[model samples]
Target: MTDFPFLGILTLLPLVGAIVVALIPRRNGELAKTIAFVWSLAVLVLTIVMWVAFKVGGDRFQFHESYAWIPSWDARFTFAADGIALVMLMLIAVLTPVVILASWHDVESSPDGAKRSVPTYFALLLAFEFTMIGVFAAADVFLFYAFFEVMLIPMYFIIGSFGGPRRQYAAVKFFLYSLVGGLFMLASVIGLWVVGGHTFDFAKLVESVNSIDQNTARWLFLGFFVAFAVKAPFFPFHTWLPDAGGAAPAGAAALLVGVMDKVGTFGILRYCLPLFPEASRWFAPAALVLAVIGIIYAALLAVGQNDLKRLVSYTSIAHFGFIGIGIFAFTTQAGTGAVLYMVNHGLATGLLFIVVGMYVARRKSSLVSDFGGAGKLTPVLAGVLLFAGLASLALPGTAPFVSEFLVLIGTFSVHKAYAVIATAGIILAAAYALWLVQRTTQGTLNPALEEIPAMRKDITLREKVVVAPLILLLILLGFYPKPVIDVINPAVQATMQDVGKTDPGPTSVVANGGAR
Candidate 1:
């Protein structure tokens, strides 16, 4: 099983699909969509097979493959997955097909007169999937950086070519922000290669970087951290996200908020902490402050958003704050919770974004003020919207609740002040999410919606098919997180070992027994 090059095949399959999709005749638009969807489905099935075959007790980096690439720079075409990467891969697989289906008529609805091409759009989507897989699966530092940078191209085209009226502006902003971040990462990668024995492999760098002096390690750490912070879009750097996410086609926004943004926190986990442990610990306090601030600030922003799509984007920023806290807390429980939050957030928020797109599709507006008492007309859509909102706010029965709870509990043990402050975001989340539902779905019926033929109709069979699996998984994982935790635990434990940290016990206990 280990000899099968599964990770290599998984990474390249979507790129191959993109090529095939692009070759289809331009007139055969439906054929192109079908091909793209089928290809995404195929990738999904293959990923499932790999997931089933993965052993919880196996080596940390499984399905490993490495081959010579840049001999002079001592880089290789390396690919592998720890439990963390595997779940992220699964997330990519699961979301791609759903995104394709939700985006089936996305280009047709836009009246911006840009002459969007469906093949081009779908091909770009598949190409983006290729980059998503590659970035997560790459074991070599240089290889990861390559995939990271290349991902921006397809997404940039997706937004610029097929998005809203201001798509060009949003796309350029997204590109420039990411490009600057990439430059920061590039400098770090070069520094890491030189200082850590001129090799770009992750395992080797981890061992070699230990000997470097404190100042050198912290500088390298900052280079990587700044790039990831921009990607994470923490606090001040996050301005690009609402614009880009608001202007992007809903399907792309789903991918953007749901899965792609996780890359920043993922990079922090996979690269920064392991490669520079002392720096990671030294910087943890500052990172926690930023994370906690982001939580409260982004939640407030979400509460105030007029555009529904942008509102969803703001919610994600708040969620990312929780993930950051979990990671920098430096406990296995918190780290594992962060990883789980990544997967669960993808599922919950992906469904929410797609649902918002559906609403926008019917009303031809993304504004909260544009809707009222939609439940009276389209009960099912209203119901789904409410459910998605609840999930976003971390309702007890939903998958996100489990992960969010874990993150707070884990953080409280080490950083009670940060943890206590961060919990306020949950209340703000509830306010924004429910307020969104109230503004769009409840109250007096909107007379204008009746005039729009599409608005009166409920979510169709195809839409139900798109959201059902996500709904089921959210509930399923909420109750039975053990399946995911089983695989994620080992990798997190390994990370704990790499950073030389242990879970801190309670300082004292008071009950019937006296404190020792």
Candidate 2:
């Protein structure tokens, strides 16, 4: 919408930073980390500036820039941000610095990290930062797709090179699954270009979709839907998440789930619905079914998880289910809530993953059985984990609570049966979250832990620095979600209009409680 090229510079900054990081002397690992953190902080500050400059009521998509990249294919280096994309970009900014700080000691602390290439790890983090920004900020479909596939590579290297015992296996599976999804997305992109007058401009494609038949639209929609569904990791596609989340270093996992996985839901909201409205409606029933199944299934899996990291991973699948309900419900309240949930999930689950990592780092294990009565030794750590669990379960006064409530009530009006089934996941959520808390923090101390002095030490100042902001945001958002909701409302309205659906009207009842 502007000639400012704000987004182009913004997107390019991190790639420049990545190259700078890669240039840092390999022996100066500490310097590499310091520079990476400093660079991320700079990006964060610029993001704040960008957020301040974003006139919410101005153009529907602001700070847009476009330059022809492939004139024949009609693709361009297009980038812009609506309210939804803006918030996600802000989230990427906020979390990147935190992940960098959290990974400060990652290489030095791990047993398998002897092979961890310090410069490579930090460089990849910076490079990954580049990809995350590009994916969310991209306006051209082909551009988005290119960023989409590029984002996966850095993460694959990060996990395989710097992750856990099963790093190679986890990395490969994650890559192949996502790679297959990318191919489907590729097909859809090509299909859109051909049927869409050989153009990949998003606005043009939206208009072009009308020229395509319903049958062809359905096939194209499936290509996109399957791609997102896999990335969203709905049900059967979800098996890779646990393995990857558990195997990656905690900081990386936080970014992986917090921001990267969101690309899936983001793709659904930004691309799928508007491009193929009929297909979206036709698929809503099945998507809702998958959402409910994912909610219940993933929650149950979390409850049975013995590995703390994997348990946290399962919890995300369940949360995504709630997000799916909100998005598919086709109401402003639910859609706005889904966006809010995405932000809160990043905060709450990101915190949970970090805290779990802290525990694992000290105790040298992630098993629930490896910890008991830990509160007595490290009350601060115990308390943080408990707070994180409470937030995860959508405790009445937390950020997730507000979003989850919106999602449920919104879905209830439209799909009562699915809403009820999804609500049950909350109970299952409580069981897993609280049970994980109690088993790890309360009761008799693990006999083996008493022998390890590291287990007795509480969270250090650096760790506190990492967690406090997220905790503060969770509580603040719970009490007042208006800021985010305001930005999200118009975008959701646009999407609703594009989908040709309106929020269900309220039933009229007379003063005497009679239906009118």
- Across 1-516, the per-residue lDDT of candidate 1 in tens digits comes to 677889999999999999999998777889999999999999999999999989999899899899999999989999989999999999999999999999998885456555567888999999999999999999999999999899999999998888887789999999999999889889989988888998998888988967878898898999998888888777767989998999999999999888888889889989999999999999999999899999999999899999999999999999999999999998888889999999999999999999999999889899999999988899999999999999999999999999999999999988899999999999999999999999999999999998999998998999999999999999999899999999998998888778879999766767967763
Scored by lDDT, model 1 comes in at: 0.92
lDDT string, candidate 2, 1-516, tens digits: 255677888798889989988988788899899999999998988888888788877788889789979887888999989999988998899899898898888775346436456777888998999999999999999999999999999999989888888889999999999999999989988988888898888888888778889998888999998889888777767999999999999999999998899999999999999999999999999999998999999999999999999999999999999999999999888898899889999999999999998998888888999999888889999999999999999998899999999999988989899999999999999999999999999999888888999998989999999998889989999999888888888998899888888998898999998974
What total of clashing residue pairs does each candidate reach? 0, 0
User: Which 10 residues in a row give candidate 2 its minimum summed lDDT?
Assistant: 108-117
Which residue pairs in model 1 clash with each other?
none
- The TM-scores, one per candidate, come to 0.98, 0.98
Residue 377: error of model 2 in Å? 1.1
In candidate 2, which residue pairs get closer than 3 Å at backbone N, Cα or C atoms, i.e. clash? none
Task: Report every candidate's CA lDDT.
Answer: 0.92, 0.90
Name the regions of candidate 1 deviating beyond 4 angstroms: 506-516
